[model samples]
Target chain A: MLFEQVNNKVVRAHVTAQSPVLARRGAMLGYSGAVAFRPVRGQGGGVGGFVGAAMSGESNPMMASEGDGAVLYGYKGLYVTVIDLDGSYPLTCEADRLLAHDANLQTSVQFVGSGGVRAAVRGAMTGQGLFTTLVHGRGPVALLSHGGAFPLQVTGQWPVGVDPQAYVGHTGNLSLDLKAKVGFRDLTGRGSGEAFTLQVTGQGTVYVQASEQKF
Target chain B: MAGPSVFTAQSLPDGDNVNPYVYSIGLAGEWFISKGAMLAYYGNIRFEAVSRYASVRDFVAAQFASPVYVQDWVVAEGQGKLVIGDRGFDLNAYDLDDGNLTIKASNLLAFDTRLALKQSIVPGFVVLIGTGRFIASSNGPVIFVEPPFRADPEALLGWADCPSPAVHHDAAWMAASFAGALQGALGRTSGEEKQYDFTGTGTVLMQSSEIARADPAVLRLIEDQTRLLTDAQAGSLGQQLMARVQQR
Candidate 1:
């Protein structure tokens, strides 16, 4: 494994000439051996990803670490969760939740599928934006959450409901439906703060943190 | 390290904590929860504003009596495993068996509908009466201390079976600041001169950290307290508030 967790809040990545790591900018806590860091635009997601990130208004600056040694990475004292992908499914995550991923991983940007207006409103409310970043191929991706994150499986029988603010990302083929239980009382400032929820269906893994805190 | 545990609907804990920062409520009935505290849930569940829920279930109105916090709370009904969190703070559930506990409004995440909530005379705090369980968040693990000690206002979580603390000023610091105040150097607090002094029998709950969350009800509570001020005093207070804003 190229990346491993030092603790719940830190991850150490062994960087080599054959395998480099792209991490969120300013996330380097410490490093060992001969490693050099360089700025990467659009998170190395290429032009399409850059345009998508720009249109969605999600700011994610990235840095590339190269050389032979290990690099320690973390951000804002957030708990870190390492996700190992087998190239069977793509991981769709908020750009801000992303900490580090293998440089060889294929990256792209995609809109939160279907549900249109409701999904858009949910994104705006959660401040996650409409477009989400996708990481593909077999590698380890490090994600940051307020508390440590856990995965919930979405199957054919049970759809998962999640607060937009607590949502981290997801993997697999899935559909997202935004549901709001707002009533007339909500208009009078007596609304349930949990008026909106994102319903995930299909076979996939959804990541949720123990907090509604937006970074 | 092993990957995180993957929980399915059936595997999610019922009325247990998912982690130190998350609690899962086994929801068979109704729970009064803070607005936006829910992280996720499974099964059939519905959330109604406290005001609207009162119309359908009149007992709800009687149970939740604090008008200042009514807008910030909701009634979650139906069967489901509801998960809640509070900005990544440490979440701990406490059971009050026929007892009362007063807590900071922002730290009280969710409580049972069986408990009646009353506004505490102390600003920004609420008293929960009756026997029920409640979930509260602290910046860190909650610490229990006996009375006869002064607590930094920001670190205090709440007090159970105890009288409300008295505002105690540092005597030597106050004496030094009195001369400065007489020289028109108002607002000269060092941020540590005043504390909540507990003297009677009871336990005080405190957090390891001193960071306090902003309470939305504080505005209304302070506004209500303004009724004690005269028109001239109100004008002066407004100007002082404006000056503080400008300084910020």
Candidate 2:
């Protein structure tokens, strides 16, 4: 996929895909022209070997030694970008597993900062991976997801509280408390059943939820 | 019962005066005698004042000054005059709201129970006195008194709801109005000048030229008004208003 900013709007140029890809709503990703395309070895193996091979000369098939096009590849296919400014960019998943599973990717994003300049924080979730990017912050934060994403809000009123196990990522600092759901007579099941619930208090927002099934 | 035998006798200390002593009393009633004179009676039995005559009024007054003794009296509905000792006071069921009774005492034999008086009731010290052990049914072993023994009016008021202004832009209004008035009079004739006076109508007036030139006075009034308005807006309703503003 490839994209460019035109008239304060993001315009898609071209999307090259061997298979059908779902178009996300907010932003499009694609490559530029003048970039070479090639097959890289050792990408389908264990994590260590794949990392080693990617940095070696053997993976230099898709190279942009002289031009502006940045080369990006998936595990199974190669995407070549040509100077087709009118073509639409294809939406592709950076995760190999998601590309294979063809999972639906949904995202909730926000932009913060001042002036014409802004910082973008986009959180995306597939069935197998949770991808979040601080596209313009000091550093990017990426979290692995066991499930898809659900958006949540916590404020002074209607504070969004959740069980600890269900917590994913929170935007600001929050408070915690222990809440009980049982009585003393039921001591055997006390703190054993759905016993204690973690309460989050304070002014901020939190996102919580899990996948529909085991990842 | 043989024709009630009336025995004219002086009060005795620590002695049980019953039946053969010619006391005619029914169920659930108390008759206390002290200093050998009739003191109090709830039934046919006359209570003689043994040592000194201490009326309920005297006991209440003394208790208010310094906590003394509290007692509970439990009288069964159908039983004859049975003097039960130290079994704790039985609270009156019809008088309780939450159904719990508590009593305070200086000694095991003496205790005091305070009652909350109605606002309509006379605003003065009033109390209910009990002797020995006060007992009740399932309701309470507690007593109710007026002019509660230990309470600070100021502290109690601090916890109570207080009045506050309702406007959100009140602080801004005060600041703007005072500044406007002060600046309007900065170079005016001294005799025509005065301090900036803020009317309840949200208007500002210069009382004296001397005060108008007083930068400290103008700043002080602005500061005071701003603080008052901020405090008012932080109250419960103000919080609700702020929430509404955010939602919008």
Candidate 3:
């Protein structure tokens, strides 16, 4: 395990003075030897870039951990899955789920959520934002899951519908459409709380966390 | 070293779980899945409210027997693999070969239509009979123990082929001298005084911890149990319930 799992819920990224690692701000639990930490804004650079990322619903503050030591990156005891972005195919993740990645990865915010008038209504109803964080040209990226993250493969023939709250991210050529089915029981308050969901279609892999994403 | 593995729909496992929390069911005809348990799916599949599928009325009648929690389940029909997850609990699949197993309603994620389901005598549990496979979630890995044991009510998931346990309490708590016992029943006692005493010869299933997801069907279960109370008793219980609600 190059990026070794110190435990089920934490990962220690091997680092030296030359090759540093980028991680979530406030996720540094501890470090041995000398480690230099500097807070970085979002995918963008400084204060202006930070505000843009936030307004666009892609704000996930990060910290650069560099120098001669192994830095522990963790968040609230969440389980970490270390992924190597081979071939730089691009990886997308929920903002809160991205724990750490190679500092050289190209990170940006992609608006994969609802758009226009419908976006506003759905956003208000579902309490979901309209952008996801995209990391490209990656080496090793660590994702955090409340319980754990699981992958579901999707082919074009059968579209996958997922609970918006449980969805963390997806890859490949996938298109998303919001779907809701309000039945008679829903009106009587006896319905399952899954009246609204997201339908993803196309050739791709969808990653979802086990627990519902609470607002 | 190779890169992180990428799973395609064709490569995903069939009739099993993809991870500790996600179970992928390869569906051809139908299966009963708990409401809101579906996370995602691939291939052509449609999830209809358990009560809304009129086309499969006979099949539904044969397979789904619990009318009490009907609103908390759905039928996934068609072709493809459907993925379901439950509040991040570890999921395990069990096979019943001409056997029966009773499971906590909240813990059951999905079950093949070949198994017939019925409401268990235990208010919050359901029993599946015949040959089929079912998926269930536990707070942690399930611990199986034999009978002649006592378990905390919250940690008891369900049991198989055993007589229902007798609700047991500490002798001191039970002998709270009539009036003291009445007060204790009304909600003033140490939690440890209560447990379920199982004396039969069968396996008992228990979760590692007492932590459980909030079950909304409890209100309906209590309402059904209230049918036994006399009018006077109902009124008295209603007042007690109101007082408890207001106190909260």
Judging by lDDT against the true structure, name the best candidate.
1
Q: Which parts of model 2 have CA positions greater than 4 angstroms off?
A: A1-143, A178-192, A211-215, B1-248
Error of 1 at B121 (Å): 0.7
True contacts kept of each: 0.00, 0.00, 0.00
Query: What is residue B179's positional error in candidate 2, in angstroms?
Result: 71
lDDT of 2 by residue, A1-215 (tens): 33221211112222234212222111111223432221112122466644543443122111111223421111111111111111122221222212111111122122121112111111111111222211121211222223333446656776765654554545444543445566774586545544545466666555454632222
CA deviation > 4 Å runs, candidate 1: A1-215, B176-188
- What is the DockQ score, from 0 to 1, of model 1? 0.01
Task: Give the TM-score ranking, best first.
Answer: 1, 3, 2
Comparing 1 and 2 on TM-score, the stronger one = 1
- Score chain A of each prediction against the true chain A by TM-score and list the results: 0.91, 0.34, 0.85
Candidate 2 recovers a fraction of native contacts equal to 0.00
Model 2 agreement with the true structure over B1-248: per-residue lDDT tens digits:
67966443332212233422222223333322111212223324433221122353354333323211111211122223323222121222122332222221111121213322111111111122322322222111111212111111110100011121121222332443356457542321211111111112211100000101112223333444555565566576567878999999
Candidate 1 C-alpha error for residue A93, in Å: 38
**Candidate 3: regions farther than 4 A off:** A1-215, B1-3, B172-188
lDDT of 1 by residue, A1-215 (tens): 89977667667799999999988765665454666665555443566766666777554767677888876676656778999998999998888888899998977776763457877786776666777778989999999888779999999998899998888888998877778888887878888888888889999899999999875
Comparing 1 and 3 on lDDT, the stronger one: 1
Ranking by lDDT: 1, 3, 2
Candidate 3's residue-wise lDDT over B1-248, tens digit each?
Answer: 59978778887779887999888888888898998889988999988888787355777866787778788888888999888888777899999999888888889989988998898877778899999999999765666667666655666778888888787654543354345445432333334346677786888876633345777777888898899999999999999999999999
lDDT of 1: 0.81
Question: CA lDDT of A14 in candidate 1?
Answer: 94
